[model samples]
Target: MAVVDGEGEAGLLELEDDEPLEDEPEESFDAEVPLAEEPESFGLASARASFR
Candidate 1:
């Protein structure tokens, strides 16, 4: 005697139900924010004195 099963059918249905119909759009950031601000000098005496 031989037996057959359909276990994969249930798994396929579950996967299809879990899938999103449409992808959400990505959010935008502020354009006014400066991205290239120069780093502060730490080793020079003049750089240290400027903070005072």
Candidate 2:
């Protein structure tokens, strides 16, 4: 329900159906929640954190 924008929403949509995320909905939700609430800046931060 927190999916608010096209980019954040699209990432979740793309990853949501992947077999790797089949049971990891919470992970995606957590990442996307902040993305929806914050600006694109936070989205970039989250991406960097994810890579770290």
Number of the top TM-score candidate: 2
Per-prediction TM-score to the true structure, in the order listed: 0.24, 0.32
lDDT of each: 0.45, 0.77
RMSD of every prediction? 13.3, 15.1
Error at 20, model 1, angstroms: 5.0
| Model 2 worst lDDT window (10 residues) | 1-10
- Candidate 2 per-residue C-alpha lDDT over 1-52 given as tens digits, one digit per residue, 9 for 90 to 100: 4456656866677666686667789888988988687877788899999999
- Where model 2 places Cα greater than 4 Å from the true spot, the runs are 1-20, 39-52
User: lDDT per residue, candidate 1, 1-52, as tens digits?
Assistant: 1223656677666667555522322111223223222232334566778888
Best by lDDT: 2
- Name the lDDT value of residue 11 in candidate 1: 66
